[model samples]
Target chain A: MSRLALPRWSLIAALSLLTLAAAVGSLLYGAVDLSVARLIAAASGEGDRVASVILFDLRLPRTILALAVGAMLGLAGAALQGYLRNPLAEPSVLGTSNAAALGGVAAIYFGLAELHPIMLPLLATGGALLSLALLFILSGKAESPLTLILAGIAVGTLAIAGTSLALNLSPNPFAAMEIMTWLLGSLENRSFDHVRIALPCIAIGTAMLLWNGRALDALTLGEDAAQALGTDLRRTRLRLLIGTAIGVGGAVAVSGAIGFVGLIVPHLIRPLTDRSPSAILLPSAIGGAALLTLADLGVRIIPTTNELKLGVVTAFLGVPIFLLHLMRERRIW
Target chain B: MVNIVLDHVGVTLGRRAVVHDVSAAFAPGTLTGIVGPNGAGKSTLARAMLALVPANGAVRIDGTDVTAMPRADLARRIAYVPQGQTLHWPLTVERLVGLGRLPHLAPMSRISDTDSAAIERAMERADVLELRDRIATELSGGERARVLFARALAVEAPALIADEPLASLDPGHQIDVMDMLRAEAAGGGLVVAVLHDLTLAARYCDRLLLIDDGRIVADGTPAEVLTADRLRIVYGIDAAVETGGEWPTITLFGRAP
Candidate 1:
C-alpha cells in the first residue's frame, strides 16, 4: 500500500544481508587484526593458536549475542508499539529493562554474582517477571494503553530508585564500580554461556510476538472494532507483556539495559514498511540487528581511552533522531 | 442471514448499570433503528447484544448463545462499526478495509482472491473506491466515516451493526448510507443501526426501538414510536410530529418547560 517503499519481502532480504555483513564486519574488525584467511584456517584447527583463541573464544560469541539481543529488542519494540497503538511504546516503557538492571545490581550488591556464573542472569530474569507482576496488579482489568503505560512508569521508577539506593549504600568501592559498569551494559568478553542463557528465551519470545501480528493489524481500527473482528484483547495483552519480559529480560541479563535499540529501530524501519503495525515487526527485527551490530562495530573502531558503553553509544545515536521524530509527529498528537 | 435474540440482557460498567433487562429479537430482511437520548444506554444495549461487553443475560445468534461461540465465528456472522474511532496508523484506505477479512485469514497467510473481491465490493458499496490509495489518517471526517463503513461492509457477514454511522457525513452521504443499509436489509441480511437523526430513522428504518433510561419505551413502526407525546416524555422536548406524508417527520420548537 505504501508506494514509495520496496516490497516487504525484498526489504527483509536486504536487511538480512546488511545484518550478515555487519556481523561479518564485527568478527573481522577488533583490537588485534585477524585476517579472514587466517580466521578460516583457525576454524579448521591448523592456524596460529592465538588467532584461533581470539576468533573462537572472543568475537564469535559477542557477535552472536549482538544479533540475538538486537533482534529481541527490535521485535519487542514493534510488538509493544502495535499493541499499545503508540509510537513511543518500547520494551523499556514496560519496565522490564529497569527491573532487570535492578536485579543485576542486587546480585552485585549482595555478592551473589560471585557465587555462580548463572546466578546473575537467573536473578535478573526473576526481576523482569516481578515487574510484570507489578504491572498486572497496577493495571488491573483496565485495557487502556494509558493505564498500562502509567503502571509501567510506576514500576520502572520504583526499580530505578531501588537501584540508586543500592548504589548509594555501597558495601565497597569495587562492588559499587562493578554495579555501575554492568548497568552501563557491554558485549566485551562474553562467552557462549551467555549466548545459551539468552537464545532460547529470545526465540520463544520472538515466536509469541510474531504470532500476534494479525491481532495487531486488527487493533489499527481501535479496541472495540478490533474485538468485533475477533481479536481477544485481554489475551493479546498478556502474551505481549510476557513475551517482552522474557525476551528483554534475557537480553538485559547479559547486556545490561541497552537503550534506544527498541525505541529507535522501529521508527527507522517504519518508512520502509507499509506503515501497518503487523508489517513493521520482522523488518524492524532485522534492522535492529543491523543497527546494533553496526553500533557495536562503531564502538570497536572509535579510538577512546576506554571502550564506550553500548548503552551510552545507543543513547547518543538515538536522542537526535527521536527528537526529530517527535517534532514530525507532534501535529498528530 | 441470521436472527439475533437478546434475552434479558443487562450491562453494568464500573458500578453503573448502563443497560437494564432489555429483550428483543432482530431477524434478517429488516433494518432496525435504535433511537434514544444521550446516556440512555442505546449503545450499551447494542454492545451487550454483540457480546462486546460483559452482560448478565444471553445473546443468541440463530439459537446458539453468542458468549459460547468462538469470537471468530461470531465475527463471521456479524460485522460491527463502532462510534467515533480515530485511526492510529497512517495505513492506506484499501489496507484498512482489508482488515475486515482478518476473521477469514489463517495465521501468516496472505489475503486470497476471495478476500480481495469482498474488499473491492465493499469499497464500491460504500462509494469509496476512488479513495483506496489515500492515507486514512489524512482523510476528512466524512471520508473517514465512509471508509470505516466500507471496512465493515468488507466483512460480508450475514448481519451488520453500526453505531452512529452517519455522525460526520454530509446530508447527501447520509442518505447514501441509509440507502446502502436498506439495500443490505432488502438482500435478506439483518441490519441494525443506532441513529440520532429521527427523520432519517423514520424514513429509512422498517422498525424503530425507542429507549429511555435503559428501558425500551416504544417499539414498532416509526409511526407508532414517533408520537408527539412519546417524544416529549422520552426526549424532554416540545416537538410536533407529522405523519401525513411518505414518512413521519419531527419539528422541534424548544425544550420542555
Candidate 2:
C-alpha cells in the first residue's frame, strides 16, 4: 500500500478487531455473566446444562444477531449516502423501510405471522418495492439532489401517515403495540430466524450496490458529466433503487424501521475517501457497522425494565453528530 | 463530411425565443467563433448545436442528425466544456480529468495505460500537469477553467465546443486559451467557442458568426464581416480597428453611436 492507503487499511483492521472483541463481550457480559470458556465448552459438547443453554441458546444468537443486523444497516446506509451524495439521505428517507414496517404490522394484524414464517418479511419486501417505485415515479426525469430529496420527503410522509392510519383503525393490542416498535424501531429477541430471513437479501444488495461505486465516483461531478462518461443515468438510478430496497427492506422487515445508520456513518468516514469512491465504500460500511453495533451495545448497557429501542439509541447519537456536521457545512457554505 | 451543421435552429426557453431561425456550419479542422453582444443567443445557438436544448431544427454532425444519434455515440464525437461551472466537490484535477476517458472505456475496463497517457497529455497541453494532484476547488478561476478544458480534451473527441470560457480570465490567460483553441483547429479538430473579446475573435478564429436580436446578422471571414457599419448596427458602439503586427485587433469604443 502507498503512504495514503495505509491509514485506511489499518483503520479498517483496527475497527474489525474491535467489533470482534465487542461481540465476545456482548455474549459474555450481558444480563448474566457467561464466560468464553463456557461458550467453548458448550460448543465442544461438554458443559453444565444451564450454562450451555445460556451461552448457546440465548447469548450467542443475540450477540450474533447484533453483528449481522449492524453489518446490514451499515452496508445499506453507506450505499444510500454514496449514491445520493448526501450525508443526510438514509434508507428511511426513501420511505421503503417505513413501508416495510407497515407491511409487517399488517401481516401480524391479519394473523398471518405464525401461519407463514416469512410472511411479514415477504409482505414487507413487497411494500419496500412499492415505495421505491413511488419515489422514482415522483422523482421524474430530474434526479437532481433537490428533487430527489423532495420526492423522498413526500413519499416518506405518505408512508408514515398510511402506517399511522392502519394502526389507529386496528383495535388489536398486539397490532397497536407493534406500531411503537415499528416507528421507534427495535431489535429485541431478534433470533436466528430473523438472521436467516435477512442475510441473503443483504448480501445480494451489497454486491449490487458496491459495484456502482465507480459510477458514483463519476457522478460526483454531475449527472451530465457522468452521462458523457458512459454512466447511463437511468440504469445507475435503477441499480441504487433496487439495491436500497432489498438491503433496507430486508433489515426493516425483521427489525422494523431503523433510522440514521445510513445518515451518520458515511459522513464519519468521508475524510478517509482518498478521492476514490470504491476505496471509501468498504470503510464507510465498516464505520456504519461499528457505529450501529456500538449504539446497540449502548442500548444493552443502559438500565431499563424493558430493552431500549435501537432506533432511539441511534437518533440520540446521530442527531448531535448531525448538528455538528450542519454547523461545519454552514461554515463552508 | 459535415462536422457540425445547424439547420434553421431556434430555441425558446419557457416563453422567450432566445434563438430564432438561426442556421450555421462548423466544418472539420476549422476554428469557429460565435460572437455577439449580451443576450445575442450565442449560448442558445451553441446548445442547439450539441442538442442540449429542444430546438425547432436539427443539429447534424457528419451528416447524422444529433437527435437521432445515440447520446453516448454523440458524446464520443463531440466534447463540451460548459462555462462558469462551479465545483461543489473537492476533487483532484487528475480525477476530474480522468473522467473524460469515460466515453471510450468499456464497462469492465479499468483505467488503462492509454487512458492515463491521454489524460497526461491533456493536462500538459492545458498547462495543468503540475497541479494534477491539487484539489480543483482550491484553484484560481483561470486554473479551474483550464482544468475543465483539459478534462474535455482528454475525451479525444473530433470536435470541442466551449461556451464563453474567456469571460473569467485575465487578458494573458484569455489569449492563451484562444491560442489553444486555434491550435486545436489547426491540428484537424474542430473548435467552436462563444468568445466575448472581439479582438481575439478577429485574430484567432478562422470564421465568425455574429448575432443580434436572435438572428445571424453577419457570418464570414474577419475582414468581410466585422466591418464598422455592422459593428455599430449590432452593438450600438463606435468601433475602432488597429493593426498591430499581422493581426487586426478590433476595439469596441463604447455603447454609443
Candidate 3:
C-alpha cells in the first residue's frame, strides 16, 4: 500500500499540473495570442480594454467551462464504470449525453429556452435522467456490458431520431441551423452565463460521485460481496445515476454532447491507479480536463476555415484510441 | 465472541423457495462446514446470514436481529467471502485486501496502523504475503482464491462465512485454506464454509451441516453427519464411512440403489 500511494498521489498532482498548464495555454494561445504580460495586466485591471475583454469575457469562461465539463464527464465515466462493473460504460455509450442533447434541442425548438435560460439546462437534465432511468430499467439488476451498451444504443438512436424529426418539421431554417451547430458541440461565443448554469450541477454531481468511492471499491468484489461488506448498493446506484445525469446533462446543455471524453479519459488513467476503480476518479477528472482543454485548443489552432467543432475534435482523437483499447481487451479476455 | 442463530430462516428467489425454514446455531470457537449437492441453497444460506438476501425468518447475532442491525455493524460482526468470481479490476493484492477494512473505516479516513496490521496479518495467515505486490488478475486461480481469502480474513470479524472457498483450489491450497479456517475457529471465531468436498469437510470441520433441498437433514460432528446412510439418502450415492484415523473419512462406492 505504501509502495503505491506515493505514485498515485504524484500521478494526481501531475495530472492537475497538466490541467492547469492546459487551462493557462487555452487562455494565452488563442487567435488573439495574449502574452503572459497582457494576461497579468488584464487580471490586475490595467491592460488594453480589448485585450481585457477578450481575456476576461471570452477565454476565461471558455477555459473554466472546458475544465468543469471535462471533469464532469471524466468523473461520471469513472463512477458509472465502477457501479456497472464494466469498463465500457460511459455517458455517450449509455445514450445519456445524446438524450440530453435532444432535450436541449427540444427546449430551443419549443421556444422555452428563448423565454428562460434555466429551462435549457433543466430540460436537458430531465432528458438525461429519463434516458438513464430507461437504461437502468432495460439493463435490470445484471449489469452486463452488452445489456448496458445495447440499451444505450436504443436510447441514443431514439433521441437522435427525435431531434431529426424536430429539425425536419421546423418552419425556420435559422433555428434549424442553430440547433445543428449546437448539436455539433462547439465552445464558440459562450459567455459566463453558460459557466454559471453548469457549475452548480457539476459540483453537486462530482461530489455525489466522489462520495461513492469506497462503495465502488467494494463493488469490484461483486454486488453480493459488496453488500456483505456493508455497501448500500441501491443508494450507490441512485447516486451514480442522478449524479452522471446531472453532470452530463449540464455539459450537454452548454456544449451539446461532446463525445468519447468520458469513455477515453478513465481508461487512459486507469492503469496509473493500479486499476482500482475508486482510485481512478480524481486522476480521470484531471486527465479529462487536460484532454478536453487540449482538444479545444487544437480546434482553435487548426487551419480549418470554420473552426473544427469541439465534439468533432474529441471524437477524432478518441475513437481510434478507443478501438485500439477494445482490440487489446478482446485479446486479453 | 459472537453467536449467529438462524431461526426458521427461509429465502424465496423469483417466487421459488431456494432455502426454506432452515435453523442453525453457529458459535465462536467452531468451524462449521455446510455440505450439499449443487443448488441445495448452501450459498443462499450464507448470503441470508449476512443479510445480502432477504430471508423470511430471523438471523440473530448476539441476540440482535440481523435485519434490524445497521449494515456497518453487521459487517463488523460478520465477514463474507462469496462464491461468485467477481474480480473485474486489476488491483494489487494489498489494495484488494485493504478493502476488507471498509466497515471499520470512517468516510474519507485513511487506513490507520491497526488496519494495516490487520491486513498484513491476514495476508500472512492466508499464506499470500509473498504475493502482496502482485496484481490480482494476473495471478493463477488458486492464488487469486487465496488472495480473496486473505481479504475476508482481513475483516477480522468474529463470524466469517465463505461460500465455496475450496472451489478451484489445488490439493495443497485446499488444505492450506481449510487449515486457515480451522485456525480461525480455534482462535475463537465462528467460521462457516460451504464445501462440496465431503472428505475435506470430514477431516477439518468441527461441525458438519448436511442440507438437501434447502433443508438441514443433519447437523453434528463429522462422524455423526457423514454416515453412509445419510450420504446414500441425501446425495443418492453409496459411500463407506471410515473412522479409523484422527478424523472420519468417506470413500464413495457407487450410485445409491
Candidate 4:
C-alpha cells in the first residue's frame, strides 16, 4: 500500500526486468546467433522450422537450465548466509558446492551417471547433508557462528577427499573429463532430461529455503536469544539442512560445480531488500538467473580453442570481488 | 512466586569446571547482582539455571525443577541475555526486538495485534522505539545495549537474567540500563545480572552475591556482601567501603607502597 518506505516494489520490478532480459538473451545469443525477433517468433510459431529447431532444441533447454541453476545457487547461497548469519559464507565455503562436485564426479567415474541420473543428485545431496551433520556434531564445543563455519570447512575437506578417492579408482577416461567438467561447471548441451532432473530438487529446496526466512531472522540475535523468542532451534536447523542439501545438491548435480554466484548474488541484493530474509530470497533467485545467464553467454562468445567451463569464469569473477568486499566489510568478523 | 533456586549446581565445559557447587536462592522481585572477576563462572551459572548446561543438580524456576520442565516451558519462564554478542547483518531494530515474541508465537502463525503491541511496549520500556527502523548494527553502543534489553523484555518472562548487562555501556547509559533493570525487578520480575562495576552494583542492586573461584564467597544485602575485607578477597582489589547519603559505596584504595 505504501511505496515510500522500503525498496520492496522497485527491487521486485528491477529483478523482474533483469530476469526477463537474461532469459531472452539466453534464448537468442550464442554461436548460432538467433536474433531476439527470430527466437520469439519461433516460440510463438511464426518463424521457420529451422529457427524453431534451434530455439527449442538448444537455446530453450540451456536458458531453462540457466534459470534453474542460477536460482538454485542463489537461494542455496542465501540460505547458508542467513543460516550462519555471515555474509561471507556460501555453499562453496561451507562445502556444499564442493561436496556436490565430488558427488557428481563420483557419479561420472563409476560410469553409473545415466543408469540413475537421480543417483548423482542424491549422492550430492547426501554429501551436503552429511557434511552439515558433521559440522553440527564437531562444532558442539565451539561457540555460535564460528563453530559451524569451522566444522563445515573440516567436513567439506572430508567430502572432497572422498571425491578424490573415487576419481583415483575410475578406469573410464571419461571420468577425467568429467572431473574437469565438474570443476569448471557447465550449462552447455543440457537437455530437457537434465532440466527435468535438476529443477524439481532445486524447486523443493528453494521452497524449503524460503520457508526458513522467519527462523533465520530470529537467529540474527543469537541462538539462545532466538530460542528464548520461541524459535524451535533444532527444528529450524533441520529444515535448513534439508533445504540446503536439496537446492545446492541439485544445482551442483547439473552444473558439476560453480563458484561465487551464491555469495555474490545475496551480498549484493541483501541491502536492497532492507535485509528482510524472505524479500531478499526471491530477488536473489532472479538476480542469480541473470548473472549466470550473462556468464554463460560470455563463455559461449569467447571462441577459445578449449571450451571454458562456467565454474572457471564464475570463480575468476567471484573470488577477487568477494575478497575486496570482505576486506572492507569484515569489520565485525 | 517467580523466584529461582540453584541447588548444588556444577557445570564442566570442555574438561574444565567453569562453575562448581553453586547453591543459592534468588529473591523474587529484587535485583540480585552476581559480582565476580573475569572467568568467575558468572555466565556458566546463568546457563546452568536455564538448563542450557548439563549440570550436576537442580535449578528450579518458579518452584518447578528445570530438569523436569519442557524446554519450551523453560523458555517461557526465563529470558537470558548473553554477553559480547556480535549480531552481524543489518537487522531492523524492530525485527530484532520482535524476535522476543518467538516463544509466545505459534508455529506458522501470523503475528497478532497483541504481539505487535507487546513489541512496541517492550521497545518503549527499553527506550528503543525511535530505533525501530534503524539497523541494529548501526546503532550506538548505548542504543544497541537497550535494543538487546528490549529483545529480552519482549520475551515477557517472569525472570530475566543478564550477563554483565552494563559492562560495555558508557556511564550515562550504564546508569539508565541499571535503572531499567531495577524497574523490571520492581514490576515483580526476578532480575539477576553479573556486574563488574562494584560502585554501580552497590548503588543499584538490592542484594549482592559475591563469587570467587566458582563459588559464592558472600551472599547478602549490598552493605553486607560488599565490605572492604570481602572485596579484597573476592576481586583481589584493595578497597575502603564508604557511606555517603543512604547508599554505602566501595572505594578501592591500593595498599600503601
Candidate 5:
C-alpha cells in the first residue's frame, strides 16, 4: 500500500524532467543566444557556422560536463552518507576532493600541466586514490563510522594545508593568479577534452555506487544485524570507498572542487523519497544535475564586473538551507 | 528442519578472548537457551555461531560450513535478532519489517505477494501489526524490541537465533516472547536464545547452557545445570531453587560467603 511518502518512479521522472529543462537552459542562455531554429540546424550540422561552432565547441561540452560532474558528486555524496550511516558525510568530507584539488594545484605548481594536456586530471585522480589509501591506513579495519570520519577530517585538513602552502609559495603573480582562479571552481570554457577525461571514470564509478543500494539498505539495521541478514559489510565498504574516490575524483579533477552539490542535494531530495538510503540516490543525482546547471546559468546571467564563480554561488545558496535543515533536525542531531 | 553445530569455536576481540574453544550442537524442534552472568561471553558465543564475529574453527548448518556459504543463502536459512541495537534510520515499522525479505528478493525488485504476506504474518506474530504505520525511532524501548523481533520473524527462516530478546520488555510481553520462541521450536525450527532471566530460562528452554568465563561450564536440562551449588559457584550467590511447581523458580538469598 502506502509504503513510501512519495513513489520512487514519479520522483525520479520529475527530477529527470527538471534536469533536462535546466540542461536546455544552460545550452541556450549564455552571453550569445542562438535561437531554437539555429540550434537545431547547428546540431544537425547545417546552419550559421558561428552558431554551430558556439553550440558544438563551447556550450555542448559545458552542458554535458555540468550534468555529469554534478551527477557524480551527488551520487558519491549519497553513497558516502549511506556507507558511513552519517548525514554529515559528503564527497569532499573524506578529503578526496581536497586531495584532488591539491593534486591539480601540484601539477600547476610544478609546471607539469604545461607539459601535456592530460596532466591535470591524471595527477588529480592519482591524488584522490592516494588519499583513499591513506584513509584506509589511517582508519585500519574501520569498524566504526566515527573512526573513518575522524580520519577523513584529518586527511582533508592536511590536504587543505598542502594546497595553501602551494599558494603561499607561488613562483610568480601570474602563476598565483592561475592557481587562485582554478581553485574558485567553474564550468567555464571546459572543453569536451575535460569531459572525455572525466566521463569514463564517472560512468564506471556511478555503476559501482549505484550497485551498493541494497547493501546500504541492509546497513540501516546496524552492521551486525546487517551481516546477520546476509550483507557482506566488507565488500559494501570497499565498493563505496573506491566508487566515491573515482567518481568524485573525476568530477573535482574537471570542475575544480565545486562544493555543496554533493553535501546538500541529498538533503534536498531526501524528504521526497521513502527515506531509505537506496531510494535517495537517483533523485539526488538528478537533483544535483539540475541544481548545478541552473547555478551555472545564474553565474552567467548575473550582471557583474566578472563572471561569478560557480562554487561561490552554490555556497551562498547552500549555507542558509543547510542551517535551516540543521535547525529542523536539531532534536535528532 | 536445520541443525547447527559449532566445532571448536573461539572468538578473540582485539587481543582478548571473548569466547573460548567451545563445541556444541543444536537440534531442530528445540529451544536451547544460552544462560550466563554478565561479561560471561554468551553474546560473543552467539555471534561466533552466527559467523558475525571472526571466529576460529567451524560453524556448520546442516552439514555445510557457514563460513563457506553465501551470505544471502545463509540468511535465508537462519534468521538472527541481535540485542540492544539502535535504529540508525527512522523507517516505518512496516518497512523495517520488510527488510527481513531482503535475502529472498533480487536486487531492486519489488516486494512480491509472498513477501508481503510474510511481513504481515511476522507483524501479527510479534504483536506489532497495529504499529505498522508508526515511526520505529519514536517507539518506546519495549515496542522497539518487539518491532525488531518482528523483523527477524519476517525472515521465515528454518532456524532463528536471538540474543537478549527478552531485554527491555514488561513481564507480560516477556512471557509472550518466550511463548513465541517455544512455538517456533514446536514448529520444527531450531531456536537459540541468550537469556539473562534464570526463571525464564529454566521454564522455557528445552536445554540450558551455563557459560562462565567464555566456557560452557554446564550443559543439560535446566534442573541439572541450575542447581544451588552451580548457582553459588557461577553467579557467586546463594539461591533457593523451588522446582515443586510446573517450572523451576530461583530466588537469590544473598552473596555467597
Candidate 6:
C-alpha cells in the first residue's frame, strides 16, 4: 500500500504538468503566434491590442473549455465504468453524447436556441436524461454489459437518424452546413460566453460523480455485495445517470460530440492507481484534460487546407488506443 | 454483538414465492450452517436478512426492523460474502479488502488508521497478507475466494453472512474457511454460512438448519439434523452418519431405495 501511493501521486503530478503545458501551448501556439513576453505584456495591459484581444478573449476561453470539457468526459467515463462495472462503458459508448447532440440539433432545428442560447444546453441535458431513462427501461434489472451496450447503440442510432433527418429536411442548406460543422466538434472561435454556459453544468456534474467515488469502489464487489456494504445502488445509479447527462450535455452543447477521451482515459490510468475505481477519478480527470487539450493542439498545428475537426482527431487517437488496450487486456472483459 | 431474527420471512419473485414463511433466530457467538438442496432459497433467505432482497415479513437485528434501519447502520452490523467468485475490476487484494471500510467512512473522507488496522488484521486472519499486492482477478479460484473472504472479514461487523463460502475451494481451503467462520463465531460474532457440503457443515457449525423446498425441515445439532431418515427423505440418498469423532462425518453409499 505504501509502495503504491508514490507512483499514483507522481502520475497525477505528471498529468497535471502535461495539462498545464497544453494550456500554455493552447495560449501561445495559434494562428498568430504570441511570445511569452507578449503574453505577459497582454496580461499587464500593455501589449498589441489585437494580441491582447486574441490572448485574453479568444484563446483563454477555448483553452479553459478544452480543460473543463475534457475533465467532464474523463470523469464521467470513469464514474460510468465504475457504476456499470464495465471497462468499456463511457458517455459515447452509452449514446449519451449522441442523445445530447440530438437534443442540441432539435433545439436549433426548432429555433428554440435562437430564442435563448441556454436553451441548447438545457435541451441537450434533457436529451441525455431521456436517453438514460430509455437505456434503463430497455436494459431493466439485468445490467449485463452487452445488453446495456446494445441498448446504447440502439438509442445512438435512433438519435443519429433523427439528427440526419432534421439536417436533410432543412430548407436552408447553409444552416444545415453550419450545424454539421458544429456537430463535427471544434474548439475554434469559442468565447467566454460558451465557457459560462458550460462551466456550471460541467462543474456540478463532475462534483456529483466525484462524490460517489467510495460507492463506486464498493461496487467493484458487484451490486449485491456493494449493497451489503451499505452502498445505495439506486441512489448511486441516479446520480451517475444525471451527472453524466449534465456534464456530457453541456460539453456536447459547446464543443459538439467529442468521443473516446472518456473511454481511453480511465483504462489508461487504472493500472497506475492499482485499479481502485475511486482512486482513478482525479487522475482520469487530469489525464483527460491533457489528452483533449493535446488533441485540440494537434488540430491547430497540423497544416491542413481546412483545419482538422477536434472530434475526428480524438476518435482517430482514441479508437486505436482503446483497441490496443482491448487486445492487451483481453481477459478484463 | 447482535442477534438476527427472521419472523415469517417470505420472499416472492414476480408472483412466485421463492421462500415462504421461514422463521429463524441467529444468535451471536454461534456459527450456524444453512444446508439445503439446489434452488431451496438458502441464498435468498440469507439476502433477505440483510434487506438485499425485499421480503414479505420482518427481519430484525437486535430488536430493530432491518428495513427501518438505515443502510449504513445495518451494514455496520452485518457483513456479507456473496456466492459468486466474479469481481469486475482487477484491483489489488489489499485495495479490494479495503473496500469493506466503506460503511465506516464518511463520504469523501480518506481511510483512517482504524480502517487500515482492520484491513491489515482481516488480511492476516484470512492468510492473504502475502497476496496483498497481487491483482485479485488474476488469483486462482481458491486464492480469489480467500481474498473475498478477507474483504468480508475486514468489515468487522457483528454478524457475517456468507453464501456458499466453500463452493469452489479445494478441501484444505474449504476447511480453512470453515475454521475462519468458526473463529469469527468464537470471537463473539454471529456467522451464518450457506453450505452444500453436509460433512463440513456438520463438522464446523454449532447448529444446522436443513431446508427443503424453502421450508426449514430440520433444525438441531449436527447429530440430530444429519439423521439417516432425514437424509433419505430430504436428499434421496443413503448415508452412514458417524458421531464418534469430534466432528460428525457422513459417508454416502448410494441412492435411497
User: Which candidate leads the pack in lDDT?
Assistant: 1
Off by over 4 Å in 2: A1-29, A32-34, A37-72, A105-117, A166-176, A276-278, A301-303, A327-333, B7-23, B37-41, B48-73, B211-217, B232-248, B253-257
Please identify model 3 stretches exceeding 4 Å from their true place: A1-6, A111-119, A132-154, A172-176, A330-333
Which residue pairs in candidate 3 collide?
A: none
Tell me the deviation in Å of residue A185 in model 2: 2.0
lDDT of 6 by residue, A207-237 (tens): 8899888888888888889889998877787
Assess the local accuracy of residue B130 in candidate 4 as a C-alpha lDDT between 0 and 100. Answer: 86
TM-score versus the correct structure, for each prediction: 0.98, 0.85, 0.95, 0.85, 0.96, 0.94
- After superposing candidate 6, which stretches have Cα over 4 Å from the reference? A1-8, A110-119, A133-151, A172-175, A329-333
What local lDDT score does residue A267 receive in model 5, on the 0 to 100 scale? Answer: 81
What part of the reference interface contacts, as a 0 to 1 fraction, does candidate 4 reproduce? 0.49
Question: What does the lDDT read for residue A32 in candidate 5?
Answer: 92
lDDT of 2 at A163: 78
> Best candidate per TM-score, number?
1
Q: lDDT of each structure?
A: 0.91, 0.77, 0.88, 0.80, 0.88, 0.88
- Candidate by candidate, in order, the iRMS in Å equals 0.7, 2.4, 0.8, 2.2, 0.9, 0.8
Please give the distance, in angstroms, between residue B226's alpha carbon in candidate 3 and its true position after superposition. Answer: 1.7
Question: Residue by residue across A1-333, what tens digits does model 1's lDDT show?
Answer: 345667999999999999999998998888988888988888799989898888889988999999999999999999999989988888989899999999988998998999987888888988998999999999999998999999999999999999999999998888889999999989988889889998988888898888889889999989889999999999999999999998899999988889889889888888887789989999988988898888888888899999988988998988977778777679532
Give residue B11's lDDT in candidate 2 (0 to 100). 91
Local error of candidate 3 at residue B38 (angstroms): 1.3
Candidate 4 residue-wise lDDT at A215: 71
lDDT of 5 at A278: 89
Interface RMSD of 6: 0.8
Model 1 alpha-carbon miss at residue A203, Å: 0.9
Cα deviation of A136 in candidate 6 (Å)? 5.0
TM-score of 5: 0.96
Please identify which of the two predictions, 1 or 4, would achieve the higher DockQ against the true structure. 1
lDDT of 4 by residue, A79-181 (tens): 7788787777787666777777777776677766679766766666666666666666887654466766777788788877877777677677677767666
> In model 4, which regions exceed 4 Å deviation?
A1-10, A28-57, A114-143, A158-178, A276-279, A297-308, A323-333, B67-73, B109-112, B242-245, B255-257
